[model samples]
Target: MKYVLEIENVSKFFYGLVAIDDLTIKVKPGQIYGIIGPNGAGKTTLFNCVTGIYRPEKGTIKYKGEDITGMSPHKIAQKGVLRTFQNIRLFKEMSVAENIMAGCHTKSQQKWYHSILHTPFYKKDENKYWKRVEELMEFFNLTKFAMTPTGDLSYGNQRKVEMARALAADPELLILDEPAAGLNENETIELTNIILKIKEMGLGIMMIEHDMDMVMKLTDYITVINFGKEISQGVPSFVQDDPRVVEAYIGSDDEEDEV
Candidate 1:
């Protein structure tokens, strides 16, 4: 099976400081691939490389069999790779629907002239994108807040808006950075179920999460890293039991099970 996203022997350095050492990870269609490590473990740095914010010094990144390493961030996104930041990034003053509609711009085919003149094509495109925005709002249970400013909503709802915006771009591989960072227990549970539903859409989901319970329960496979190097990788159960992971990430067996 062709992987949805493939990173082969990839490495990134910042002024001689190793941010992401040699690493390889493949995510299949509909798979949830988790990257977990302690703070400063380079998880986000790896995300940056994959999303084209930083080009790897070595190795390659492929999406659906196409080499996309070093591609511009916008170009990568146009090619069906979209991501959310560790912190929620949304148009604070924009209505929820409008924020999601911003994402739809990537898929729009209308040119600036068409929009300026209100051409038939632009009208048609507008309808199509608005329909998509409505669908996303309902899917994320944000219909009630459709006209509300995103900043006025709770943190959890803001997160939903960001995810919905990413989905609006129609991505094949979605990269989420610390998605559950500030969510409460109940909100996190809700987000977990929402992600499982997204997996059923057959898009590969790659996430860097500090929530070990969420990682163990939600990920189809996991890569444990330490100081920019992969320490262990396997199914959740296997990685959960690996000694190296225990030493580097999960606490010792003597401690109460945290992961």
Candidate 2:
């Protein structure tokens, strides 16, 4: 398989508390990989480590065959790895279009002086990015709400706006934390469609989600972690049937008595 991201023996410690334990994983290009675990299972910590939020205590991370371990978050993002938080993080007062435009800042070449003076190149770049933003808004079906304040939109639409903003970065690997949180059935279905559309666009995705139905339907491979250790990794159906996985995560009703 053509791997886009690789993590080898990665581990993290917070003042001697182990958050991730020698975690190793790979995400192939254009594949939707799911990371599922109970709360405090170190899933978010793993995401943080991969995205440069925290440097791992050991092991290495590579992207496109280049060592990216210990890089800054901004640098990782520049290398085409972008992530969204579990909590919806939008500029409450900013218009939906403006919020997306903000995400394009890293790719924008218009310097402060050029932006202030409105130089020809600045105008050209601005127009180009604006057009791209419009395209993304349309793709996510948010064009009608483009001018609305992000905080005023419904919870589901706000989540869509977050996805659109993430797309504005044109990332090769998108790491989403609970994108389906706070959504109704219809919204969840719509979000699933958006995720599939993103994968079809050839972007590799690694998502940490608790919704098994969504994860099973959307992911090409599954990795389950419990108490900061990965218990299983394989195709969804195979992982679902693994005895260790069931024991660690999906406990049977009768097994609850033993616990």
Candidate 3:
């Protein structure tokens, strides 16, 4: 089967420091591919390369069989690759509905002039976009907060809004960076269920998460990285048991544990 996202022998560096070292992973449609490692393990760096924030010095990234290496972030989003940051990024002052609608601009076919003149095409596009936003709100159970400013919601709700905004763009491949970073246990549980529902939508989700329980529960496959290199990758069950992954996260018994 053709993979929805492929990172083949990819590498990236900052000055002389290697950030990603010949990493390779393929994500099939509807799969939750996980990337997990200790702090400073280059997990986010790998995500940056895939999303075009940093171009790999070597190897290639393909989406739907098209090479998209080094494409601008907006161009990547236009091609249906969208992402959320490790920290929440949202329009704080915008109402819930409006923030999601911002994501639809890329999908809008109306010209700027059309919007300025209130042309028929623009009206039609607005209607279509609103319909999508409403559907997403209901899906995320955020309809009750539709008119509230995004910043007024709790952290967990803000995360939901960000995910909804990314989905509004209609991405086939979604990259999530530490999605459960600040969420409480209950919120993380809710997020997991929401992600499973997203997987049911047939979208390929590639995520970097440090929450081991969440990773083990949500991921179909996982790649464990350390010092910018992949140390192990396989089904969650296999990865969880790998000695190398164990060493990377917790270190050998000989090494003194850091406080």
Q: Where does candidate 2 stray beyond 4 Å? A: 250-255
Model 1 steric clash pairs: none
The candidate maximizing lDDT is 1
Rate residue 20 of model 2 by lDDT.
93
* Predicted candidate 1 versus true structure: per-residue lDDT over 103-214, tens digit per residue: 9998787788998999999999999999999999999999999999999999999999999999999999999999999999999999999999999999999999989999
lDDT agreement with native, every candidate: 0.94, 0.91, 0.93
lDDT value, candidate 2, whole model: 0.91
Model 3: CA > 4 A from native: 257-259
Evaluate residue 24 in candidate 3 and report its C-alpha lDDT on the 0 to 100 scale. 96
Q: Write the per-residue lDDT of candidate 3 for residues 1-259, one digit (tens) a residue.
A: 4799999999998898988899999999999999988899899998888888889999999999999999998899989999999999999999999999999987777887998999988899999999999999999999999999999999999999999999999999999999998999999999999999999999999999989899999999999889899999999999999999888877887676553
Candidate 2 per-residue lDDT over residues 38-73, each given as its tens digit = 789999999999999899999999998889999999
- Model 1, residue 195: distance off in Å is 0.2
Q: How much is the lDDT of residue 16 in candidate 1?
A: 96
TM-scores of the candidates are 0.96, 0.96, 0.97
Error of 3 at 72 (Å): 0.4
